[model samples]
Target: MRDLPDPGPWDEPEQAPPWRPEHGEKPRYRYWPQGHRPALQALVDGRWRTLQVHSRIDYPDGRVAYQGEIELPVEGRPAEHHHRAYWWPQPGRLRVAYGTDIAPT
Candidate 1:
């Protein structure tokens, strides 16, 4: 309707609720059974490394919301980066939702 304001980003329907974590499941690796290629990469210092990925959830048409980690050498010490990634074919592509370096648990 002409009276309706144009929808900005938040108009999409919400995704289904994610499953509850198992007891003591502090670190979980949820994943799809199949995905082609290592769909994302990051350049660290002077080198590149393929990220290790797993999905917390996915839709039937290949839309996935995932989390993963990468091992990086920071100032000669070992570190891990926790990241969230998403795959959406429409206006969105495979990309990092957000990420941060985290201490090992």
Candidate 2:
């Protein structure tokens, strides 16, 4: 019979587990209205991180009218991707803009 390898520290379950806020935490920058969308923020290793930005529009019947997502890069210079629903009404099509001196990847 073959001997099984032992699991490392990560393989063990949490004793106390992590704490998650009930009403969610605050963000560094201004966020959109709650009815408009969902936003997230976090601090890792003392550095601020913007996790996600999501939003939706609802119809009178309580159906999803529109949806959008904004994703950020994981490392190095920050990058963002903006995606939105095709049916939402807006002026001038959505445009992608990067910070000053940053080139699109």
The most accurate candidate by TM-score is 1
Q: What TM-score would you give candidate 1 relative to the actual structure?
A: 0.32
Q: How well does each candidate superpose onto the true structure, as a TM-score?
A: 0.32, 0.21
- CA lDDT, candidate 1, residue 64: 49
10-94, model 2: which lDDT tens digit per residue?
2211111111354234212223454443433322233333323343334333333233343434456565553423222322322
lDDT of 1 by residue, 1-105 (tens): 222222222223122233344322342435434442233444444354445554554544445444455554545557655343423332332344343343222
Q: Please report, as a residue range, the 10-residue window in candidate 1 with the lowest summed lDDT.
A: 7-16
lDDT of 1 at 49: 49
Instruction: Check candidate 1 and list the clashing pairs.
Output: none
- For each candidate in the order shown, give its overall lDDT on alpha carbons: 0.40, 0.31
Total clashing pairs for each candidate: 0, 0
lDDT value, residue 104 of candidate 2? 16
Point out the worst 10-residue segment of candidate 2 by lDDT. 10-19
RMSD of each: 13.5, 17.6
